[model samples]
Target chain A: MNPPNIIFIVFDTLRRDICSIYGGDVKTPNIEEFLKDSNIFPRAVSSSPWTVPSHMSFFTGLYAREHGVHEDLEHGDGRVLDKIYEYNGDNIISYLKQKGYLTIGYSTNPWLSPGTGFDRNFSSFTFFSSEYMNLEEMNAVNEYKRYGKNRYEAAKNLILSGNFQEFLKYYRIHKRIIKRKREVGYPFIKGSDLIFDHIMNSSYEEPFFIFINLMESHEPSALWELDIDDRKIKYLDLSGREIISEKKMERTRNGYKRSLEILDFQFGRLIKYLKKMKLYDNTMIIVTSDHGQALKEKRKIPYYGHGNFLYDEIIEVPLIIKFNNNVKINIKNWNQSLVNIPEQIKNSIEGSMDDYMTSEYVFSESFGPVHDFETLIKEGILPSDINFSLMNEKMFYPKKAVYWKNYKLVLNGLTGELDEFTENGKSQDPNEKKEIVENLKEQIYIFKGQESFRV
Target chain B: MTQEIRIEGGLSLNAKVAIAKIVINDAIDRFKRPFVVWSAGKDSMVVLHLVRNVAEERHMDMLPALFIDHGQHYEETIEMLDKISKEWNFKVIYARNEDALSAVKGNKIYLKDLNKENQEEAKKIAQPGEILKDENGEYFEYSLETSVGNHILKTIAMNNAIKRYRIDALFTGIRWDENPARSWEVFISPRENPPHVRVHPILPFTERNIWEYTFKNNLPIHPLYYQGYRSIDGKYDSKKTSDKPAWEQDLEHTKERAGRSQDKEGMMEKLRRFGYM
Candidate 1:
């Protein structure tokens, strides 16, 4: 039997808090409009803080350690599987290909290009190649580590040697590099054009699986807007400002809201396209984010970018699925992991997706804190309002958080410290929480079989 | 002669018979002191037949059949009960109100053949049921309230008989599609106080399957069912409108308990919840 076409629209770094569907400040009409017919998972979490590892879960149905892609502890080491030498045909890409699906991919992030081993199974793949005008590419130019480890060593020596005049010159050159930055639209307009292009141009004679990774909601968003009143309400316009302050962080918070408006507009357009093509009913459209942004909301971690900590701000992402019918059902299975993305797709094809459950436990993990604890402390990250104890013992611990029933336990590998979040992410009930922590620890031990974890 | 009984758009005659056997062997017969509540209706007769057939095949003990005499059944039904009881050598128990027994004489209706002039005399001798009806009638109110009262009286008698026979589980032939309340009932229902259980073995069957199974097997049922009566309670609480038998009537418009006069008032569920099978 031919499988229904699968379209995975992953909004890179789009957090759960901003989507109005989950009761946030931003009004995402496209997402809300889709919610009328789709199933909304309010508390769906991401596997990782960034695009690379998080998308790996969607493909392999495996966590960080199991899939072997995690935070690059040794940065710029060729040991990283950024580019694949061969297609293994073991992951979701190959799995779907064997099922007779024509696989294609469109990415805006060069890091997600074939060089990063992210696009191996796509029969045809498209990347903008030159649009690195935002933060990631400009920063790559700043460190002089744009794409290679050779320049990284040279740039490290130049910055470490502390030649003030040469450093200023390099900063001037980096400013010039940023000035030439493209992708000024940030995420939405260009993306919608590509989606509509696919729909209008396709013969669509056979079932096809299209994977889209849009990077508009990621950090350093410029020119994003939505009119709330006579005056426009949006994230701060970070045009020429490089210096950081309380003013900048507040604007970044607003930036997330403005980014959501763009996401909603572009997403609505594609949905309209799907309907116009009359493929809305038979097609399976899944919209979710790879992970969320920190926005420095709680001051738990510093900076507006993610990949530093496992706060709800960083891991929680909105998930919505629309297929044929519009009957809304509450699927209360708390154990749905991001790693089961492939399984969800398979079940959708087989007509056996149980909206209520997938397993007893869903997981989220981090190789280490998004930033090394030492860097965070040295960066004056712990605000004066909070205590030192939170970052003291549990700081350096490489952790994995498992959600069970009504409790979430963060298993710290370094100190074996079990950090608990109770119902609605509270931590007050120690007596009841400890027992659950211990049982979940044991379940993990049984699952891994070879290692012992401190409860 | 198999009935293509469409239940929930799925159930067929083979499925109905298979479900009957499974419910009997798996749930009903699992309990000690199990007994069948036979109403001498098509449904109850099928339950009895399934049990007898299971016993013959598996060498299981034959359960005692109990009947609650509400003093309103026809003479032919009472006669068929005696005949079937003797033929199968099945132990039979009768539960009835002691005062009402005297009103019935030798397998005949109580005071039913009286002249219009003698009706007042009969009314004077009539006793009120546990539940009183506002409307006036001879011997009984003949209203839904009276039917509910009679149902309670019958249930009390059945409970007494259950205690006498030490019945732990009572097997019934109620189908889900039969009535509104039964649709929500399960195959095995629990009763707390007496620690008794109600096992409904024919829950998934439809009315057509009941009739077709009986017609094909030539199983004995109430004689009134064939005499233009689809269902039975008594002459006063019944609809004898059609000339054709129950199975012969169009199944769509033919309600299972439409003939039961009290059932028209929709009090059957109340009686059912009160332990009246």
Candidate 2:
């Protein structure tokens, strides 16, 4: 009868195909067990296949156009919070806080910080801190705590250094390396560990909203820790020569599976902890992922990245909700979106059918890391590796895709090609399926989010 | 030939300069020799200076600007115009009612038609609050049809000048806030049917913009402006009559053209309709 305590969990980069609950080959018994009384969504796609912009949509109920937080690889300049303030005014966290929920955030994502306006309205917010958990990097820990200010101050320093362009160029050149090094100090804490700590230590009031992003199941090669990866994550010039032997590939696959099992175990622990506190009966659980992993499957080149692509392996992920208190609402076996979960939860709280949202289509976009084509070409990257014509037409071709029923149309803004796909990511013959293709293209063109952005 | 120049506009001093240059360039291209109606006021002076600058920049012929000598201007105003004309080397058409010009030039044959005694009486300058009386303190009924009214004579001289120069276009520094009739005017407007066009380069500029641009560019404004005579015209506009003059009045509180007697008679609308700047 009372307001339910909501638990929103994001198993970062957890593929729907790999999760047993979504009928994947991998064993995720914990998620499968959680699905018994939960409403399950098999094909829930993210607004973006990455954390920052995707989470922006989740918080504000707006697409990238409305939030204006798409990745700007060209500038690589300011924080997402500065860009987001102009567009995102109404926040779901603030709404739920007004509704008398003791909101708390337990996230490992830097994108989910106060810098990005994500930590507002939360009574207590804890991060899976790199220094606090690892205890080896004290200075990095301080920088972690002062993330926004530090980044801002560093940017100011760069500008005041009187060589801002050089600084930007250097940052752009070494950004991926710096990022990889920075991830060494990233909060790589396991979800189960966080849940255990919360259960054992912190005591909050009833009807609390806990938002969690667990990063144990993030990348296949670097599944063990953010520090251990030696191989470069190739995307633009994945010339197939970067392929590891079958034995090494099997080891990487096993490492990903091991991390998945750990995530599942941790999920089970979270559920068990809730039951132990006599809170399982009253808690509402919404399960999904920020994105899915890409393990160089069904492609010409060996690519091991997610954010740069819009394939089902990158965007399509699971959505599960155990709303035991709100028994009147149950959606099953229909194509929906991970984006609608925030609004749906708000509607379920307000007990309104008129304002409740339902969507027959879901959309996704890929803002970029900005591949330097000149460097790619000079490095003797074959045209087969990445079609040069796509880059030739536009310096960067950010992709926008819309999924309706079984059909999906991916429009590459740079190349100006609208590639359509049918079920299981199979390329569709557009001439044969003329009506749906044309109707879907028109609908995409006229969509409210694409009004100003003709590309 | 008129030199071609790029036209870009913004709410800045540089943009106004660019727009002024474009207006002058466009006038040259659009007409045989376009005529600009110069009033020796701040707006007119700044725009005229801009035309001179553009001419110097492009190494093109200067604007064929015409100053309508209404025969009632102060000697000081005439001195300032002569000085500027000598500096800029622009073609100066001292357009008048022809009879007025003849009288000034002492051409007795043309001046014989004038009534000498009434002309001397009409020419006698009087101080403010002394000569004018209509029960209303301010002159407000606007008309331009009278033979003696300067509006008709100015329009006649302007039309003759347009015909003499074979000008297909005329550029005017008539700002939007001057009157209700000029408020809705666009940047480029065609008048007197086809071919004869009116180009308003600074139509979007406000009074504040004009002042700000003058100060920003260090453009020389008329000397009377500093003496609190904001709207400086030849005959009726002095610090004595209309009190401190319309220019001295708070631009926000009072209309800029309020000091001019002919505007009160609604003659400005008729003059504009007759293609008078």
Going through the candidates in the order shown, the clash numbers are 9, 5
**lDDT string, candidate 1, A209-324, tens digits:** 88888777776553322211101111111111222455656766676677778768877877887788777777778888898886645433344566636777778788888754
Q: How do the predictions measure up, each by TM-score?
A: 0.51, 0.52
In model 2 chain B, where is the ten-residue run with the lowest total lDDT? B138-147
What would the per-residue lDDT of candidate 2 be over residues A1-455, giving only the tens digit for each residue? Answer: 68788888888877778877766667878877777767676568888877877877777766664466766545321345577655536678888899899998888665676555678668877776422333333334344323223334445666777857745753453455446445653223344475556755777797788888877666534433233232233433343444445565565666666767777877898888787887876777888887887776765334465675777888888777777453535454446766676677886666532212335667787655434444433333323356545433432446777888777887765554674456556887888888987666644553422122332
How good is the docking of model 1, by CAPRI class? incorrect
Over 4 Å off, model 1: A72-78, A82-89, A129-183, A186-205, A222-244, A299-303, A324-330, A369-395, A447-453, B1-277
The best candidate in terms of lDDT: 1
Binned by DockQ into CAPRI classes (incorrect, acceptable, medium, high), candidate 2 is incorrect
Tell me how far the alpha carbon of residue A184 in candidate 1 is from the true structure, in angstroms, after superposition: 3.0
Interface alpha-carbon RMSD, every candidate: 24.6, 23.8
Tell the DockQ for candidate 1.
0.01
Q: Against the true structure, candidate 1 has what lDDT?
A: 0.63
User: lDDT (CA) for every model shown?
Assistant: 0.63, 0.61
